[model samples]
Target: WAYPMQPIQSAAMSGIGYSPIGPVEGTWVVGFFRDGENAQDPVMLGTIGGIPQNFPGSDGFNDPNQVYPLSNLNFHGLGEPDTNRLARTIGTDILGRDSKEHPVVTQKLSTTPLFDESTGTPIPYPGVPIESEGGDIRRIPKALAEGNFWVEPPTDAPFTP
Candidate 1:
């Protein structure tokens, strides 16, 4: 079954799992299905570790020093309500630099297909223009699709002097 690409902000754990590059606050049970497989046939994709249980209340986990509950954290289950807030938190945690001082993440298109709601047939997702030549729409065939986790900064892109 082909899964449509959703922006990192709103996509389910499957698409997001392929990238595996952000903060998720709860332990997640991600499920995966083979192409053309029934939704009921999903195989275990394994679990994601959420915020440590012991994290202090100020940081928002149940306890600053214990392992956190695998199901209760909202950010892990639903994501930050505001992308900016998510961006800033991840920016600080992953890069150790201020989100204001550097670009947090770059958006890219994926060739995953969104299935028809009722018939379950694959359908092309609407396209959007991007700064690059072809715009942000991903046009590659899903069988040959590849996911990129790195960004190439321009020669003039800002850097610490």
Candidate 2:
């Protein structure tokens, strides 16, 4: 197992306050070996995001399990750079080139086959006051009551939603 170096932001003081690094399988990471020359013990600095050149395969130098780069009915993010769209909005980027802003959540949710016209897939979600933290898009209170909101259903859900 690799030893992950904690960031300066993280409080790695006591045993009480420790957070695990979350670099998952198929995630390309930048790291070095603790026992120099011997690649037995890895010291992971962080993961890197980049444009995937090819689909994963069950060979060396790539996803050996071939688990990642999963495809949906339409979306297969191969070749596309993994820049977080929210990070750079129109007029906010360092480059002077003007880029379009992300559409409202309630608008046409997805272009892929997962786009559901019913619940307006990827509907308006709640936001938090704190900006530094990251979280998932959540539904507004009693949003389902408004009707036509069934979206990507949970596996346990009996009916489609």
Model 1 residue 125 CA deviation in Å: 2.9
User: Least lDDT summed over 10 consecutive residues: which range in candidate 2?
Assistant: 127-136
Candidate 2 C-alpha lDDT tens digits along 1-161: 54444342222211101112244356665678999997899887755555566786767666567755544321135665433222212111211112222312333222233334787675322321111111112222344456534333223324421
RMSD of each: 13.8, 16.1
**TM-score (C-alpha, index-matched) for candidate 2:** 0.41
In model 2, pairs of residues that clash are: 119-148, 119-149, 151-161
Total backbone collisions, model 2: 3
Q: After superposing candidate 1, which stretches have Cα over 4 Å from the reference?
A: 1-17, 22-25, 30-45, 48-122, 126-141, 145-161
How much lDDT does each candidate structure score?
A: 0.33, 0.37
